[model samples]
Target: MRFRHPDGSIVHLAYCTNVHPAEDLDGVIAQLNGCSSLVRKELDVPVLGVGLWLANTLADRLANSSDALNRLKQALARNNLEVVTLNGFPYAGFHDRVVGKKVYLPDWTESARLDYTLDLVKVLADLLPDDASYGSISTLPLAWRVPWSRTRDAAARDAFNRLENRLAQVEATTGRRIRVAIEPEPGCVLEMIPQAAHWLTPYSGRSLIGLCLDTCHLAVQFEQPVDAFAVLARAGVEVVKSQVSAALQIADPSDPAARELLAEFAEPKFLHQTREYGGPGVDDLDLVGELSGHASWRVHFHVPVHAAPRPPLTSTTDVLDESLRHLVGGAHPLTHHLESETYTWSVLPSAPKNQQELAEGIAGELAWLRGRLVGLGLEEIK
Candidate 1:
């Protein structure tokens, strides 16, 4: 889906395909022909923009072989799907049964991360629509907070500097500009918007690296979206993209049912960083026990943007709304890319029964978000 901003720039609304477990190229192609097509049809849109998630191996293949790239591009065109951005956070093994901390492996402090990002750049440059102004990729926030040293910090900065130069070179070669959005999560080296803005202060001159504000993570940290955006603007940090999402909120952790519900969401699949409403937080749900039970708690679980959980267990869609107001409703557009990134479908307490059900759930989310964007004065391009 595409929306026209008041400034005449096109805002792309896409759903990240990282939710699907398709690492191999064939599986991805099947998805384009199957669920993706269904989603486009369900939305009744002529062109559907997708936030593509390519496995490292698949990215290498596409970047290295023009024939392979053309095949993937043709698959998308055949399915009426378009690409404007890529989710670069999970390198590989995203669908693993236990991907708690491994998702942060090979962080920006290492060369492997740089290699993978460049591959994504090459693939995205060709896949993006000719009318699309730019492409965005969201990555991890440097590395895990712990086990990081000055040397590692220096290395991460150096990696980003090199990434900027390489991105510029790619723009020169492809005539397409692709920017990287450093996604900060709870307990990461750079967690909050203020810290991320401070870290990004030096790169104000570099237009390729910016922040990808995930509403789930932002709400979990209790950062008001209005204030968060103000800080980023003051730091001159570009909001390249926003994962339009919501987080699970426990109104009162003391309630026995809510606590039990937490365990249900505590599967070994992903890390669920839990935070008290306006107090201290825990890095992972494993430490959720440490949080005081006297107040509301928000988990880093990406809930559907449109729906909250059962009664008494609300979602952070309220926070999501605030972010949307600034990102979409403002007179001028601050970010041109918005992605529905609820990748926790299978882990939900009420997980979809089948692929068709999953497609319906995803389409529901996009529809809800589309209505919200339309309400914000964004013209949905049919």
Candidate 2:
């Protein structure tokens, strides 16, 4: 939440919590408060903003809208946390419907969805103080829910139109010009940087509709950090929010080599003969094979199963640093939240080392980022 420059100056840094450990309001607030305390004490900086996950928290509290809004307001006020931006929302409600079917006819007309989305935005906008800024509410492409093969130019155009129309309503209702960040995800219609740029061509020059560059998603698309940033800049797409993450590209466990090896050990013929003779058949052979192969493949492709004092060849630090540099060096002033969204952290073998690792990893990233930002003449928090 804060960073210090080499010159000994301090500045407030903003970020979000992607790992949701709490489902209740009190629990969520406690987590936020704890994070804020660490930022204030350890980082020695003020908390500028926080990102909210709408799907898990807000959606559940929908029936108690007034109470939910009040609780959110109280949480922010108590922790001295300001709303930087909100990601998953309005769109997440129809996630299953959109992704399950290859079409995104939003169950409502463009006007209807626009009104509904805006109404929700208004409630969130009202939650923030007059001087506070709200970052992008997600603007999902219709094709995001649909399959890639089914996403044609005509469908894309219609989707874009619907998005633009709804965004306009959001702007009107909020009475605050919030950016509608179009996030790119793997397998979604806007999977690649080029695809996202192409879709944003009409609104690229506009500030209202922008892009949210999520590193993990981009990694999945095999986009290099520098190249991805360049594409956004070239397209004149404003990055409303930025996330940091690493991808784990594991080999398929059911590949030929793995299958053959499993077959060799289990030997289907042996199992059949044993079954006929009422002998001890293979004990859950499928489960054994799956577990063994998965374990083997995980160790084969990812970083070493153990941690090293020095950085490993497979460490994602370099790419993450490059991404931070790209943002720090960009012309547009970086607003919103710089979320440490390494969601796959638990999947990594080094995750069980306790809170020290979590704290150290986050602090290390912030330290590296601060150095870059300070080099760019941005004031750092002490």
Candidate 3:
């Protein structure tokens, strides 16, 4: 779905397809026909935007094969879906049951990371609709903090410099501008908005490089939505994409009920970085045991935005609300894309029991977000 902000800028709303956990081109195509189509139908919209998560092999297939790319383009058209942005943070094995720090393996310092991203850029530029002027890809924030160093910064910078030039060439050839947004997560080289802004402040390629503001990360760091945007704007870093997600919140961590439910959430599939209010941040939920139970805790787990978890445990819905209002503030457009990115549907505490229910969950998030955006005075471009 698309909306026209009061500032007259088009904001494309999509649900990231990473929730489906497909691995190859055929799997991606099946997801479009099966899950994504169900989601579009559930919303009953003429067209719905999907922030696709293409796996490494699929990216290779599409970038190197015009035939494969055309099949993908045809599939989107048939499913009444469009792609203006992609979730490129997970190189592969995103759906693996034990995806921990390995998700950050091919960091920006590696040539493999640069090559994979370039393939995504090429594919995204071609996937963009003819009427769309830009496409965005969300990537990792450099690398994990532990293994990173000032010396490694040069390799990362050199990689991005090459990317900037290639982005320019893609835009010149396709007339669709593509920008990569570094998505900051807890324990990464860039932890949150302030760190990301500080790092990008010195970069000369401002236009082609930017940040992907994941509200889950924002809330985990206890950063207010309005103020976070201010930090990025101050450093001249553009918000190319915003993932409209909510993090799991427990106001009273000592509550036994909350802890019991939280245990259910601390699954082994993905990392759930946890933070204590105004205190230290842990890489996973188990580490939260080290923090004070008296303080509020926000987990990096993306929860359903439309509904709260069982009582006593909540979500950062307020953060998502504030961010949407700020995005449509009318002073200027902060970002062009917003994706309902609750990719942990399979492990959600209130997870759907079947494929039909899964589609409902995704459609429900988008519907809830659309209502909020409309209330914010953004006209739905139906």
Candidate 4:
């Protein structure tokens, strides 16, 4: 999936591989054979783009062994899958029993976080196509909201400076441009659009560090899709990639029926950060307790973009549509990458029961996004 914007710049559409968690390099290879290959076949296309999610352990091994790295590349080529972007947010144990705050443990403040991300850059450079000029990786924000200390802030600043230098060296040596985009979740330090913009203020002149705009996250924060884009644009923040996904929206959280509907989506595998609007805004890490509020409520759950859940619960698919419209509706496109990141399929109450249905569901989201892009004057380049 490559599409040509009206201005002729290529826009790559991909589905994030984080949906299928692979803990090691071997598991990653198996996914290419079992999952990615099937998805590409379902689309009936010669090539499919995938936002590869390589865990910390897998990245460390690949960084050390060229033999293993070459094997991974061969597998991707054999499967007709290409990697243009990566979901580097998860450090490790993404598929564990409870991935609560561990996802943000070694946030941007630790040296290990920086090392893991640099290794991913090296691996991505090796996996990128010879003709591809740039690669993108989305990472966690600075840290969680609590435990915000000056020491932590300084550590994060130092880590970012080191990362900036490393990205420069990678480009200088390999001739491939790689960028690390910081993604804002619902409860992280840089949780909203304006906060992300503020974090990037000092690095205004830098292009390698930017924002990874997730439509689901933005909607969860109660920010309008167009307004979010405008804030990023006004701040001179480059959207390295726009993740096209939707969050579960509950109109009135106080309603008993809506609460019951949301309870079905509350699981223990991943953190379901919830956001509710009453007078101001409220944030919750999970949906375990009662969400009593009169205003609209949005959860961090990544629902299928093409379909909604049962009654009394809807998805913010309209927000995704509006965001894409603002990005590609103009003569010049906003970003070159669009990745469909619905990684909650395994936990969704209505997830596909079989592998075939899962593949169709992933492909369906990509197809829906493709139609929208084409309607906005972009065409599938094939």
Candidate 5:
């Protein structure tokens, strides 16, 4: 899970644990024992990096009790696992029956979202590796695009001010700096790189606030990876972390069977923001909404990067490859943390039938991404 970039920087690769959603602290511990152990063994490495996802209940426990925190640390050490990053996007109940828009609840305008993220910062500070000087947490972009206003922007600014103060306190006390990376999705207020740049211009040089670039989201919007990276760099926006993920792309959107093929993934679990590639941009609520579109479409659903489900239903792995090349193949690398995040493993149309198969799929993705990095003139260090 450790690699030496051509720039002489050590980058850590991890697979996001949000794929295995847990309800409480005990469930999370179970994952470290069951899933994490399996993945480490599959990789056949002495140590593996895991980007953990802590729900509200588990985070609250770790933040309040030193014993719980120590238990988690011990678990990680026992399983030859380490954590330099976390998926703090989902606050609560991520595995419910229907998590449609509730994932955006308690937006930045509310104090709850700020409190949850602050808690994550505290936990990440404790869980960082010995040689690590910093950690990362990827959060939701401001909020859902609808029901947004200029007044909400002011509220968001206030929240950021509070978070900045807290981050300073953490760094001053622990000497471990943690940055909160706001991840941009399709229908969020800061969907594309331009919108993210416009809102983040004010916090130009602030190290605690930056963007978490997800390749799947960019591909869904039809924005070329190199073009997006150029825009971010030109805007002085730093990418604190990058999620190596792939989205579902349709070759022919006008075909009715293609719509049916995409519909099989439209479960009641999460939001699938579907988009079409006309001369202009096309938007729809979900994949089912784009069934009538005549142009090509891509869905926000994260799929396995190593393989496609079937013909006419391919993945956006090419975009992910290009993004990684731009990020690390330069004279200077963008970020030191790369996490493979395919959280929709269980919800995929032709997903693995069992837990062992799921672990194999995730390990395969991490290996595939590692190979991609190695092919770019980087060396994998055991």
Candidate 6:
């Protein structure tokens, strides 16, 4: 079940368990076990663990009392699955400052938000199986309201302090270090490599906190994948886990007159057009509402499979190849878990006749990753 490479490093493939609906946790685990068996039989490797996105919510709902943590432990044990990590803190009560309006007030007061985040981290640390390692607990810096000119603004300082405090508490209680991976998301507070480095420098030499380099996020920011890997390396920030996807930077394809309207859209006149007709061809009112709240919405679009295809779209296959070349080749062996985050599968123009296509997509990506590692002179675990 171990995939060892010639370089004395082992890479174990794991995946996010959110592919299935929350109600189907049991069925999801069954499918995972089946997948693991197939990988072992066919590929001769075992899936390391299952990543859970709803750790906080599930912990809250399933385990509501002091014994809630114990209940979660028992449930995970019963299912023979371990929590690889929790993905985002979107619901940690932080406000959407980037897209804020009178209608969208701050989701939580500063103190309340910090408390909720700490509580969630604590629950995660307490509930994770003894053998499970903490994956990426994201700190969404952009969600905080602060002036860009002042990096050490009170709001940013307080947020970092809260994060450090929570990380320390988790380590103390769990006796296992939790990797708090700071994801550099485009349009977020710490969007680019330099910003991520600057943010992490404050916590110099801290092992518990590191970077979660999502290729899609970096691509949208126009950062080369290799360059990003080097930045994280120089900053001494470990690349804990990565979410791979492609980003498109172009005029809104939904706009019919996109060519001619590009200039107008860049002007204040486009704001009027956006307000009136919802920016032409945008039929979804809810999406229009999201766009109206955030101007950046029109800049980069997440093209679902069903959506119109565009150029420069990086496939799961390409992402895996480039990521492995940079990561494994640079002497940064695959220590952290890897998840095939092609969630757009559901949103594809049409669902495949069966789950085979979806499974093949993941399997192919993993196989491509293995080949890259092997080509880089890394020994494959037999």
Instruction: Tell me the tens digit of each residue's lDDT in model 1 across 3-90.
Output: 8877788999999999899998889999989988988888889988889998888988999999888889899999999998999999
What's the true lDDT of residue 201 in model 2? 77
lDDT for each residue of candidate 3 in 1-382, tens digit (9 for 90 to 100): 9988887779899999989888888899999999899999999999999999988888988999999999999999999999999999999999887889989989999998989999999999889988775899999999999877778998998998899889988888878899999998988999888999988776524588888988899999999887887787678888888998999999999999999988989888899999999888788987777898879999999999988898788999999888877776556667889999998999876679988999998999999999998888888987
lDDT of each: 0.90, 0.50, 0.89, 0.86, 0.86, 0.49
| Residue 187 displacement (Å), model 5 | 0.8
| lDDT of predicted model 6 | 0.49
Give the runs in model 6 whose Cα sits over 4 Å from its true position: 5-12, 21-45, 61-80, 92-113, 126-135, 144-153, 248-320, 332-335, 352-360, 374-382
lDDT of 3 at 69: 96
The reply for model 5, stretches above 4 Å from the true place, is 279-292
Better of 2 and 5 by lDDT: 5
CA RMSD, predictions in order: 1.1, 10.5, 1.2, 1.5, 1.6, 7.9
Candidate with the larger TM-score of 1 and 2: 1
lDDT of 3 at 286: 77
What ranges in model 4 sit over 4 Å off? 278-291
Of models 2 and 6, which has the larger TM-score? Answer: 6
- TM-score of candidate 1 to 2 decimals: 0.98
Instruction: Summarize candidate 6's per-residue lDDT along 27-71 as a digit string, tens digits.
Output: 434555554334333444533345555433443554346654565
TM-score for each of the candidates: 0.98, 0.65, 0.97, 0.96, 0.96, 0.66
Task: Please tell me which predicted candidate would have the highest lDDT against the true structure.
Answer: 1
CA displacement after TM-score superposition, residue 274 of candidate 5 (Å):
0.8
Pull out the clashing pairs in model 1. 1-49
Candidate 5 lDDT score at position 38 = 88
